[model samples]
Target chain A: MRAIAFKEWLKLRSWLGFMLAAHLVFAAWLYLSIRHQFRFEHAEMIYYQANHIGRIFYDDLRYIPLLTGALIGAAQFLPELLRGRLRLSLHLPMGLAPLVLAHLGIGLEALLVFLALDLAALAITIGSFFPAAFIGSALLTAAPWILAGIAAYFGVALTLLEPRRRYQAANLALSAGVVWLCHRSGQYQAYDLVLGGVAGLVLLLAPASLQAAHRFRNGEP
Target chain B: MTSRLLSWLCLAFLTVVLAAILLPAIYAMAFAPRVAPTHLFYSAVKQDFVYREHRGNHDFTYATASGEHFDRKAFEMSLPFIYYKNMELWGLLPIEIDGQSFDMQAIRDARQVFELKAREVADRHPSVPVHALLDSDPGKAGLSFPEDVFRMKPDRMEFLDVDENRVDPALTDRFTEALAAERFAFPARLVAGKQTILKPFDEGVFLVDAEGAVFHVKRVGDDPVIVRTPIPTDLGIRSIKVQENRQRIYLGLVLTVDNRLFLLQSDGYGLVELPSSGYDADRMDYKLLLNPVHPTAVFGDGGTVTAVALNEDLLPIAAYSRAVPGTTGMIHARISKLLFPVTLSLGTGNSGYLGWTVSGPAPLAFLGNLLAVGVVLLFGRRRRIAPQQMIPQLALAAIAGLYGVLAIALLPGPGPATGATGG
Candidate 1:
């Protein structure tokens, strides 16, 4: 399993590096834009815009994390699954579940590293000029975006892993439904309670992937 | 055995989930809820329903009991003073209403609205949250943002001047001493403050202390006005909402445990309880309109919208209430009534959270599940489908509804003679 995980890490390392650099660029852009606006205008005006007008400064970075997750999943899983390498790989020395989980785990860890760095960059740039209260709310607003990143990775994983075209389409549909739940919220921190359930949905995708592997091993047409 | 168990568990869960999703979608598409029209507005004072037909928004027409209709222009013209701005903009001002020429400025000055919504109310704590008292009497320049936000400790009060990044000992001590003079109990139960600087003028804030004693705290120039209101002992005040109104008649509003409404009058913090009930602070949304003539207070507990009109005396003039049906009524209700004996729902029509519960059924909501399972069983008749596989297939249809049906059709066993894990 360690060997397989290490193999997975080797495959994902390049994508991880790319995502990290791309996200840092985005963070720099967000910070620079805020600074340019605040340089000309009053700090009090920006504060008033948020407090009175209900404007969120970080609204532009909404889908960036989502794309990061989906792309990471695609880069890691799509090539392996589409080439039917996972079918050949499943016959290795260990139990099927651990091998699949370790494979998925490597991709998830890379995505987390990228997200943490993105948040730190946000705190440095936006945090420098804005008050503690406003910056805190902006971070909470970024939570859903990060959650979507995780969901997108798992959804794309399950969709690609299924053997039959019929099952693959159904799995993708179900995966999309779960991701849709994560994005339904309009406000920050509104999804705090239901996040546990969403985690369960993502984990359930693992078992579904194993089932697909079983069918693929049995040579199902 | 372990590997086989994993396979069955996976297949069962996936089957149940897909069945749950598809069954409901097909049933819902065929039989969805209907959009209800607005109902009667019964006027208790006049003993008749004021049948208002809203033609979109401002484009509405009103009719009397005898069916004398007033169009949008005629309606504004009739009220002359109520819709004074509309009349003036349309060159209908200066026309005397009821032989008395109404001053538009006077009417504007007298108009005041303080919306006290229960859902919008902040719950009181044993020890109050953060407090900020703005300089209510900022001289010359009028209302401006506070230099600092003040917080109360158990025995002492402190202020963090955000601009200076240090303690504002002078103003903090002045206000803290005033609270002591008024005998305000420390370790405050609920501390609320106005943070916004956009107002005609600041009206300061209302707070409750450790002993449930309510106090009016404000900054009058550099001096502090911290006085305890004469609220009756043992009165459960849930929250205090401060409103800065031009009328200056009332300092703020208080919503209590009884879902009762009260005005903290400007003079000596006198409390006036308005006639209202059934406003559960947790569930209902309330809106208050303050017009010089006919003010109205409307509150609803989602299922019903209750409106009470008030005269100038702040007493109830007329009341109107109506029942609003729930989502699964009419079409969804009719279909569910005719089809299945039970329907399974995840969250709700409004929310997308994953909460599992069973609702009133569309009896044959599982028809899709049954059909798919039947076809699978038919093909496998010669292969002899095991009770383990066959029973779950049946249960998915019975329990999951349409989504179960779709799952069975989509997720099949590996093949005949191939045990497919648990089997």
Candidate 2:
């Protein structure tokens, strides 16, 4: 588990750095905008400013986890399948379930590490201006994690089902469709429904894809 | 088999989706509170003349007597109590004339006297300041005097005739030109018995009687003056003229004489004695009533009076009064507080809801929660998934939902404390 976590950490380093950089720039922009626009005299005003900044950051940051999860899930799973890496791993001492579970474990670790670093950066930035409310800050810190999990679930299922050029194209088309539907619904709120539906679809599709892979590994035509 | 499994999975997803949507709706419907409207009344007083025409009674006599002086201290003592008891009833806008402060009450009293006396004077001297005669002098009579003139200012004087009408031209042009560039003085005669005096610092209009005592004249309207003579209590209006629709009520005995008129209108939420034009020969000793009739038929302590031409059933067909644009379609019904819910819907089709929407706050919070949950779930599935990975993502989604809940809690709820302010 520890080795798997470390490997996942190494894979996620670049993405985490990007997330940090983006959020830092966003936080700086928020600080400047708030300082310029509002007179921060009272504690209530400072709290309000912090809350506004948090909301803006959260709105933008929400998309990052979803995209990252999908990309990482596809990259890690599809290449292994196309190259028959899973078969080689299965031949080792590990059981099929353990090998699959290991991949899920690594993916989850990367997501959690990225979320923690990003949240810490946000807290430090906002804390300079407002005395942080522990509960509120903690709550805000947790939002990115939820987004990443939904993204990862969909990515895994998509990668497992079709590890080919056609599958890649289909995944891209489906993602675009999801984004289009969310935008046209006139309520970005439908993102949750889409994500949940996609997660369920992936879970349903995963077992079938793995069974086909298992048959191929056993040399059964 | 795969298709059946997929269908069951889809069904499970649909159930979750429905619960997510319905839960927020139920919470909002149960917890949200309502807001109400604020109510208030505003009033102002002015000096004007009231008069009645009697065709064959020409026996006019002039009597000299002292004018009743207003006691400011007495007025001040009664005022605080009036404000405490009837805070919503009276609106007071006080003015100063020669170091004497007069409230709305004084203005109402002054208006009653002026209207009654002006009518008598108009009847007696039908030819005085005759517009026909003045029209003959084109240069001298370019502008018609407003029906009611109340407050006098240095550069401007406010005149309130019957219809809240006003006449204000540059003093430098109108009066200075008429007075041959001389600083105009009060009690100055444009013609004898028909004088237009400039109050001190051009403060107000002070129309004087024959013996040189100042009688305040409050203008009512543009039409020929209409006054009601003392009919025996039993003798009601037999058949009021259709054309002469606007009317005022005057009461009280004459000052220093047998017949006086008091304007029966609210001033600062209470009754006031306004000045009026005196017509009897004993003008100095005479009292006058200058009750200014509101244009609207429905009257209350502080509500504005707008005149409407009603059918025999008292249903309004045509109304003549000042109203803001877009308010012309309003059906003015005297609805009880308890009946507001019923009557509120009756006129709403014609008049758009001039108030806020009740469900505006709920949808915003729900949307926030959805976005938060979607983003967290997406991010949580990224690399190698593990039990630990779910913890952070789940925590974040919960946090976002809490923030949305807090926003909804902060919004103001509904109730009966909202009212529109008058300009």
Candidate 3:
């Protein structure tokens, strides 16, 4: 467990520099946008203006994690399955669940590290204009981060279980359907819950997990 | 297992927070009470004697008389008929003094004296209608009283008075008989020193002293004219016929007479007349006014008093009225309250564009949901990359967080001048 967690941290560190740069650029753009849109004449007005800026920042921030999860899931898991890497992994002196959990843990850790950096960047940029209540506002602004994290976790688990070209196609189609349903019902808040539940259930019931021990015994590779 | 548990925990927390934010609107919908409705009325009195003195700079006396209730109900019911049918009676009554018509000033003075004597007489009797006679000469037809009286003189000159004491009775009787046959009689009543007759006759008399001061006598029916000095001490007199329905209670020297229209009824406090000036009929609100301009400024509880000033072409140039206080304030308060629920709901949806502008802060909950979707997509995208190649995924996550902060900081505050656009 410790080794796996360490490996995840190493993976996260590789992306730290680029993530920091992107956050800085986005923060500057957001600041300029806010300044152009609002003119604050009093302290109260300034507070209100800050709140608006924060909400916009958070709304766009939520999409990054989910998009990242989908891309990473397709790249890392699908090819391994097509090439029969699962048999090689099963021969290792580790339980299949632990090995899969290790991969998930590393992905989640990298995502969390990136999220933390994003949060720090937001706090610093927003604080310059709203120094008095920066922390409170940032925490309030972080609510989206939690929901995004949950959806990413489910995505990683689903990709590992259904690591085939057809399954990936099916997952993409299903994602579109879920988005459409959410938009039609105007139920954006419940999007993560629905998506997370569906993905997690599919992963838990994956045929790959049940066939892992049998495939290893037969030496199918 | 730990990762799955963490995910479940996060979801549960998000649901609870959303429910908490929606509570205020739910409670308001379920249990908020409605406000009660109210009604109001308004009217005014114009050109009455007290109102005239009040308008002018004169200090006239006032008196009140009480009799058999004066059948106010009958008067009020017949008011419309009287106003439309006999609108001419709305003008000033002509009073002849010493065979000369009295002007506005003299008539005003006579009316004041009549009010005083009436009040004095009513103080004693309190039941009978007091009739105080004015002293005037029957032969002085050429003498003019005052300008206003002259302006109101009858077109026909047949109604004239002649002195019987200065002419032969036989010749005067024939002239008097002819005038009587023509329904013309002496317009002035007789005054023997301080005594005066209140009845109409052919040869009524008046006595004027060296100072031009006059006194009148009282008469009952065709009975011999009573020569009582200073007139009868007490005769019940209530109010002068000014405008229809409005009356001025004699409040000492009437230096200022206000047109008081509606009476406020406080269950335990009896009836308190509301001043026509300060009361706002449209809004049913009241404020204090030092001086009011019109006599007919009175209106009932729910009535409105509008001031209409027209230009030379009779086009309405300016109009003024007061807004009802409580109602106006209440409406503004309600609007302010509505802003809160709408603002909160927007915040919950991560929909920063829901406010007045597309760039404004959206619901925090909405932002959260968006962030959740973004993370899921980001993680999925990076799944095929080497663990060492996760730099771009991390970068995207950072970008999403920063965007969230920017949206919230630009939200507009509540107020009219802020110009926060509606959702």
Best by lDDT: 1
lDDT measured at residue A19 in model 3 versus the true structure, 0 to 100: 55
- Per-residue lDDT tens digits for candidate 3, residues B142-166, read 2211100000012211111111102
TM-score of decoy 1: 0.77
TM-score of 3: 0.29
Candidate 3 chain B lDDT trough over 10 residues, lowest sum: B144-153
CAPRI tier for the interface of model 3: incorrect
DockQ of 1: 0.23
**Best-to-worst DockQ order:** 1, 2, 3
The candidate with the higher lDDT, 1 or 3, is 1
Kindly report which residue stretches of model 3 are placed more than 4 angstroms away from their true locations once superposed.
A1-20, A27-46, A49-59, A71-86, A131-135, A164-221, B1-423
Question: Best by DockQ, which number?
Answer: 1
Question: Poorest 10 consecutive residues of model 2 chain B by lDDT?
Answer: B414-423
Identify the runs in model 1 with alpha carbons over 4 angstroms from their true place.
A27-38, A122-139, B1-111, B123-134, B140-142, B146-198, B220-224, B291-295, B309-313, B316-320, B325-329, B336-388, B409-423
Q: Is the docking of candidate 2 incorrect, acceptable, medium or high quality?
A: incorrect
Q: What does the TM-score come to for chain B in model 3?
A: 0.16
List, residue by residue over A60-122, the lDDT tens digit for candidate 1: 677787788889889988878768777778788777777777777888888888778777777
DockQ of each: 0.23, 0.01, 0.01
lDDT values of the candidates? Answer: 0.64, 0.33, 0.32
Ranking by lDDT: 1, 2, 3
